[model samples]
Target: MASNAFRKELYVFERGPEGKPVMAVIRNYTERDFDGLIRIQQESFPPPFPSELWWTKEQLANHVHLFPEGALCVEIDGEPAASITGLVVDFDPSHAEHTWEEITDAGYIRNHKPDGNTLYIVDVSVRPMYRKLGLGKWLMQSMYEVVVQLKLERLLGGGRLPGYHEHADTMTAVQYAEAVLAGELRDPVMSFLLRCGRTPVKLVAGYLEDEDSLNYAMLMEWKNPFIR
Candidate 1:
């Protein structure tokens, strides 16, 4: 449990439907946040996907070291509930055709270029218990804040199609993605990205080794409204 003093100091309070106060805090990731972030990743992404898919302490530390301002997290009641990790990269349309490993350089974020024009979102995770609370949107807004501060051209990322596994046998990844975009289907990640003003550019196959998404992901981009 979060200490009352810590909670009071860090969290922002809002009234719940029952008139009780709900606490939410959004902040940057720190080295000490490793354990909490790993736990959130574990709970958020389950089995059939190797544990290696999750970031190690060293990797998380490296991300913070390389791009401290790009890592953001949301804490609810003083516990880590969600996070978004990003890296700066020069925008390349060909990137939409690359696998996750190629795009992120195997999650080492070595492709992070300080002078890059685009902010590439590497991953976003929210604990199952905290889903549907608009926390994802809050995190995206935080990412946008970083984009504006950096004067980046856009935000880009691969949106996982967790709902793809069920429809994989019947349709191609692009077809499924088109359906989701057309409102004929709802994908947990893609739908949220669309709602946040992201446009799906293409469906990249084998983007990740996750069985749930059948290894397919949507390449999505959100142009910075402040860029113009």
Candidate 2:
């Protein structure tokens, strides 16, 4: 229940107390925005989902009218620049085997809180050239403000390292694993989370024998009043 004023005002990004034109605003996704979202995802993620999987008229219909609550897009001058998909889930740090759906469906995470609740942030991506400009961090803060208006308790994100296979010059799976082990690996989205005061509590390894490499899945958490 973010205030109408806050939601409306969120479109602008802050740059050292000055509003910059490069700011991104969060809005509901539309069919026209799908292609850009897909392109950004393809470039940002390894093994991205095929464009056909998501860029469909049917998907657009569902996203706009149905589950649009957590489907958010950040736009620059009304053009999509970044996007995120988040869902509130029951967080069970102990259940390593449970998929995201299972945890939420089982009521391990409560949708309605007797008091304060939590906002479980899912996927987030910013267009490559736009990195480090604070768009990602601003979007996250906007979500936090939304949760606060709704009196939610916390925020969370599933962090992952991009895993790829080498066909020629690339080291493929081995490089992915090495990066995970060496601590040289980092997820840009997760790094944004850290700048906003999140702590990584768990790391799940992503491995593909065919590629012969390993990736990583990290779990990060942040509570309200991010600055304490």
Candidate 3:
């Protein structure tokens, strides 16, 4: 849960389809927000992914302890509707493609490097009811703010293709990613990342056990525009 002293909010107003302004409150995660975060994760990601993949209280605590400023949540009607979590890491091309466990060290976040050049995104989730409101992009924009504040060179993460299971028998993960990039196919997550100017760096096998992604994930990166 977040400490009352550290709780702060940023109001974001977006034009709805009818030209009405939709208001959302973006704020940092608090210790009290853990259950809501976990609930959102469960609702956002369905079966074939065990509960272990969800952010445990311990993991959340570790993240907050290591970098409290790296986690942010978007609240709607006083409930957490979306959230983003990340950690700073030194970039290493030689070890660019790492599994989720390898990158997060089993969700302990012991690898966070304050002086690192990369902001490695560990997780980003939005409630199912809030999908079409452009909240995901808002969460991402907030992440860019974190990158700038930390003076990082880039943002990196393994993007899951929740729709990949449907194409597993027909195409490889790499092929699917290329097709999505070429505008031939649409993916809930990958397409959004591409639209945000993130580039796919590589295909990582066994990134997670999610059957939807066929156990494969795309290594994606977005370079910091503010940094040369």
lDDT of 2 by residue, 1-228 (tens): 222433333544445666565545676666677788777676665454444433344544444443355557777776777776555544555754433444333222334222434566545778776664666777677777756755556677655443432322565433554454466664444444667777766655541112322344456777776434
TM-score: which candidate is best? 3
Tens-digit lDDT track of model 1 for 101-199: 876878789778999998998888888877756678878877887888778999999888999889988998888988997999999889999998889
Residues 1-228 of candidate 3 have per-residue lDDT tens digits of 334213345554444656445567887887899999999999987775677788899998887788887788888888899998888888786777678887877777889988888988888888888776777888787787778766789999888898888888899888888888899999988988988778988888999877778888888888888899
Candidate 1 vs. true structure, TM-score: 0.86
Model 1: residue 209 alpha-carbon error in angstroms: 1.6
Task: Decide which is better by lDDT, 2 or 3.
Answer: 3
Score each candidate by Cα lDDT: 0.81, 0.55, 0.82
RMSD, model 2, all Cα superposed?
A: 6.6
Error of 1 at 64 (Å): 1.2
What's the lDDT of the predicted structure labeled candidate 1?
0.81
Residue-level lDDT for 202 in candidate 1: 80
Query: Can you give the lDDT of residue 36 in candidate 3?
Result: 95
User: Which candidate comes out best when scored by lDDT?
Assistant: 3
